[model samples]
Target chain A: MPIKSMYVTYSDSIYQFIYFLVGDDELAKDLTQETFLKAINSNPQFRGESSEKTWLSKIARNLVYDHFRRKRLLKFIPFLHEHEQIDYTYSPEQWLEAKNEQYELYEALGKLPHHYREAIVLRKIEQFSIKESAQILGWNEAKVKNATERGMKKMNELLGGERDA
Target chain B: MLDSKLRSLERKTLDEETKNSQLLKLNKRNKDYMKKQKFTYSVTLVLFGLLLFVFSQTITESPKSIQSQQLTNFELGEVTKAYYLYSKRADRMYNLTSPFYTDKIFTTDPAVLNEFELLFKNSEWLPFNGDLTKYTTSINYLFQLENGESVYLKEINEDGFFVNPNTMMQTKLAQQSHEQFVFYWMHIYMGKNEFPPWKIGLLTILLLIFVYAAIKSNKRGTIEKNSSLINLSGLGLAFFCIHKMNEWLGVNHLLTLLLIFTFFMSATVYLHILIKKQEPNWKYHIQRIFMANIVLFVLFI
Candidate 1:
């Protein structure tokens, strides 16, 4: 497929996936573009053994890994901290209701170990099947199941589920 | 409640402008990459063609020279012009030779004719088949015949011609006096030249770039050709560059060790970038390598 049409078809889905992983509209937009760019640049002959959506998810996941790697590398230099801004696209009523609760939850998701966060996003949030998540994340089926289960419990714990109780 | 929040979070998709703008960026990047790929292919073809041409020229000597060798026994009535070069590099002679010189054979003793006949009869041709690009010859004899053709052997030293092992060139050379050798060295156009074997390194670099680009162009979906090409080419490029770097530095010293280590580090990082399927900064790596080479050259030579 010509790259433009392919992007038009899958850009939103990929962008949303990246947005949830990155928790920033602008960075997610950049990485979404980076996903397609990396795919075409590095592997132009993507024949879709898995669906194109799966292939794109794989690329976006790699970009997220790279993003966190750079972030981790930057952690050593104490003064350089990125003030991550949370800007969600929402109607006014949804924004008022979600402004505090969803913001904290999304921040918690971002703070999760990347693997867990990725599994939770793919499994619980994006609704990818366990097998599909395995294919995308390059893990075995059982690993995917374990990560999803552990990831959901971790997310609840991160939101003070046990602490509040 | 967790499932509901996760569902609600999924509902918050990107705004339309961001999606469309990103589509435009992807479109632009795709077009840019296609252009870059075409450029890489064209450059690689041209470099490979150049390499083939140089080797071919080396292996296949000028047919006219071969024809002249056939007529070596065609003794001349009178020589037109003659001047022999002295202490010269094979590289410079192959690159350029003045067509205005004649053999000192005519300016010497008349008994030289008998000497020439003897030289031809008992001539022991040393067949040196080294590549002309890197091969250095202490060539001296350059002769202009009646037909204005230069009979200059590529591997000519102070004594005689060394024929290419591949060629059927059986030309013989008479031992010349020291006076005659010095006479030609004093010529206005001919002088000693110092030729660096830089072209070999260049062709090596070009071949590497061709292979490296071939590796990158290999697609991921095809495991058979793709992964092997990447691993082999990356390793080969690293190996060849290391060898070439040693040859270039020409000394087993600190600088050479430092440079090779630095180079291997960059290559390892590049391998990581490829393995991870990160956005390929191949052009960055290529430029960095080429720049490192240029810098090393400037600093050393």
Candidate 2:
């Protein structure tokens, strides 16, 4: 694919990845735009050491880390409005009836610990291969697989497995 | 059965509804980001060009001398000789005005000492005149006042004060006079010379450049890259101190001391910034110490 078309095609997937990490629609949109702008303006010698998708994902992840660092989130966890109690469980029929599961999924992702949330976003939402996720995240493949498994198990515990529909 | 069902749900593909919404959002955001980046880059370019123009103009201008040739004549010889002799005796103080009398006194020829002396005596100046015997060899007159203050006046030929060619005193004196004139003019008259003002302006321009670079990096979401601006600011500050020290102390003992201290402090702070990888809080402390030193030096001057 030409570089421009490839960028356009992958842009929304990158946005979904950032949305999964931040759990705020506006902020995720902003970060996603920033991620692609950076990728396009960067020196063209990307050399494919990893897939373009993985490289862009790494840039998105770094931007998310920077946002949290600036917000000093670790120092003010209790004050985070996004972490307030929410109704996670849903009857199967009710889940089918809701118009937007994406927002719900995003909020639940935000409440997860950083490592687990990152693993799930890469593995489940981005649907990156386990090896690609590990490379982008600077983790071993075993660690990536373990974190994804643990993150999904924790998600089951949070939502109580009622909305598999 | 539950695990298989969960797997199937997780594997669901992106429907047209979600894909279209994501594309619309991405397109709007990308446009906004590109516009912001372009605006920032243009502003930076214009500022950089303006600074360069100002600095270049400053460097190309001529330097003006501060010493007056009118003060070097034989008619003013007596007053000038007395001033220099007094200054030398007073631990090299730079002020040439009389400590005894507030006004200047003029005399054309120094050979007629009694004429000058009689003029003072008729004014009822009752201060000590050591003896008249010294006046016979060279025209010497003791200008004495009732307040017990005296200045020994001497005659000079057409030849003026002899200055040694190899002495550093002449160079330092010239620099000191220029600096004094520049400082006085800047503070009292809102005027500035090309050299000092240019140097100060250039350093300020460099500081702004680094700050802009940092902001650009921040906008691009690169915080670590922005740290380079902090380092650049630190270096610019060190150069500023060197420039100020050159003006204040000249190229002499005091200047040497300032140079060594400035280098040592700047290097130490640079190392700290690079090694610790923390926000350079120590740079502010170092700047405070340097400022205190400048205050003390200026007070002495």
Winner by lDDT: 1
Cα lDDT tens digits for candidate 1, A77-142: 442133122222322224434577767777777777667777888888878888779877777899
lDDT per residue as tens, model 1, B97-147: 323111122233334433333444555453344554443445534445466
Candidate 1's DockQ is: 0.19
Instruction: Show model 1 residue runs off by greater than 4 Å.
Output: A43-47, A72-113, A156-165, B1-10, B62-301
How many angstroms is residue B114 displaced in model 1 relative to the true structure, after the best TM-score fit?
33
Candidate DockQ scores, in order = 0.19, 0.07
lDDT of 2 by residue, B1-301 (tens): 2234333333222345655665565566656655765576567558746854654343333322223223221121122122212111121212323232211222223343333333323221112223322323232222342344444443222121112111101111233433442343234222221346665576567557656764654333323343555666656565555444534333243335645665776676576557543323332345445544544443443
TM-score of chain B of 2: 0.27
What residue pairs clash in candidate 1, if any at all?
B81-B102, B82-B102, B82-B103, B83-B102
Best by TM-score: 1
**Residue A22 Cα positional deviation in candidate 2, in Å, after optimal superposition:** 8.2
What lDDT does model 2 reach? 0.48
Error of 2 at B278 (Å): 31
How does residue B106 of candidate 2 score in lDDT? 28
